[model samples]
Target: MFTVLPAAGGYTMSENTKVIARIRRLMALGTRNSNPHEAARAVALAQRLMQRHGLTPDMLSLHDIQESVCQNLTSNAEKVPAWLSSLATVVCMATGCRCWFGWHIHTSCSGVKSVRRSLHFYGFSGRAEVALYIYTVLQRQLRADTDGQIAGYRKRRILKNTLRRRADQFREGWVSGVWQVLQSFAPSECENSMLQRWLAQRHTGDTLGNVNVRAAGKCRGDRAARVAGWLAGRDTEVHQGLTGAQAQQQITAGGCTHE
Candidate 1:
């Protein structure tokens, strides 16, 4: 049995909290009993709760009684690249959060200059966490696929310029695939508007840029590589009920700990 609460702040935040709590309880029970069937049932229930309540990652933040909103900073040893920024933007949009890039300058071991890139995620705490986890997983998958494809081209004695073009093509295809998947998971219209308003309040100067895809670039890459990468991007095998430090470490280990 579950309890439903009245809506709050023009959204069903209270009701969402109760739903999420129930989901978490079910997840814990499944884990304790080591029952895969129970876990699957819990995941199904979670999906239903999310759909029925119009829940986005932002709504999950409402579960925290101490704060109405929260933010998280994930730092990497490497400088932030345009591709990473693009991926982060996609994840943020899909998870109902806002993200921006920052640099953390520090001195290296040899007293040389070093700058660590940081991705700043702002939203409800729960949403921010989920956004980061998803970002980590996607980043890992992208890098691995790109590397493997580039290596295969090199083994075939492909020209440097051609390989570069192929890499670009793979990236485009991967991004397109990820965008399609994220769109499938998009929040409800009401939740989308609320998220946009929240982002507008905090990130007044941020504006989305238009992306132009070139047909020639897509045609130049290895068709097999692009398709494989795209398929990987569409894979969504995440533990929806995981949260806090445990969830963070689980995905970050091989995913995006250092970029």
Candidate 2:
């Protein structure tokens, strides 16, 4: 029941309707599937549809859609690293979803204090779902990459303090590099402008915080390792390339059931 008013050269209302229906179905399939492959396929399909029609995630209006707002509580603030939080913000913004952090404070009987942190998402149901899915996948990939780097440093017999410092430096570089690459995936200016107008009319202030990561450090000959990590991060498969129309239609009809 969503209505997307046609902008010049944009998809027709009929096309928008079809796209929105397909997105909802895909989202539902993604949610039900425990395997992340299905979710990734759904995201790929949505990206293809948006690219084919020159549409952004926010272009399809959800005024009449009955999809409810959803929220996910992440790990405690103390456990979540700054780089991870920044990456989450970047993913939410790139996916056209709004996110904020919430802290839950508790005190033990022994007078020790602790805080649990959560990242809250608010937006159209389907987009919010997609944003969380993307964030989870990216976060895992980043951690794996960081672990690999740390293992390599350990193998090199570097001093303990130097190893820790270099690991931190590498992480900072990798996060910053990945963030820069992700920004390239943001919606086009025209689409963003349209989205701003729509949100303004609805009075939804979807603002994202800034992501700040330290510059990658280079210690003597270790610059190559940092550069390699940055390149690998940039090459992370966040979004798949466009598929043929037949493939896209098959995906849409099957609702991401295909492998």
Candidate 3:
């Protein structure tokens, strides 16, 4: 999609700037695949690359980086997500992030590590919900598409090859369906009530998975405190069957407050 940006006076960004912006947008589109630490690492890597190329890398904050990234920077070369790369081009050139856009190239892989479910991985649940809804619609439509093809292949005596192809197609379809179904299915739609109760604290609403994680954490911590308090009682007197270590463990796990 074409966007109008503030008109610049004969200003053209260098290739490196274009490449860097593309990289940022590409990373942003893969929102579920990263967290803040990963974003930080990415930011560090990008900064270093700029430095190596003898350019000054702007020290960008997390919010700045996120905004810059979501803006969809791109170049004619399109080294990144070719689809959204154009968006990046307009954002970078038109409404600049005030980053010290330059031609330096710094390189290092020190900051990239996988942190599961960090904040950088945004909208996984929401996307998953939408994905599930889409998948259900697709599923009801798939067999019609493939069954028609299989019947044709059978009638043509496209026998042996067609049979294998049919099998492959069915397997592929099944796998695709399962994935889409899973993606669209929220954790709240989970079978276990206890788990749902726990998750409801973190991801709430009309969706099955709404829950307050903070409340859950407090509950877990409080349980430990209560257990610790009970264990302290046992410390002075060992019960008939339980040993001191076991008593201590039981108490600690129960969530007793030390003080």
Each prediction's whole-model lDDT (CA) = 0.53, 0.52, 0.29
lDDT of 3 by residue, 7-87 (tens): 323232232556556445644544434577777666666556556654332221111221111211111121222212221
TM, every model: 0.48, 0.46, 0.19
Return whichever of 1 and 3 wins on TM-score: 1
Off by over 4 Å in 1: 1-82, 180-219, 222-225, 236-259
Write down the lDDT that model 3 would get: 0.29
RMSD of each: 14.5, 14.7, 25.2
Clashing pairs in 1: none
lDDT of 2 by residue, 56-105 (tens): 64445433211122233333433344555667666655655555554445
What value does the lDDT take at residue 197 in candidate 1? 57
Q: Which scores better on TM-score, 1 or 2?
A: 1
Candidate ordering by lDDT (highest first): 1, 2, 3
In candidate 2, position 203 carries an lDDT of 28
Better of 1 and 2 by lDDT: 1
Would you list the rank order by TM-score, best first? Answer: 1, 2, 3
Clash count for candidate 2 is 2
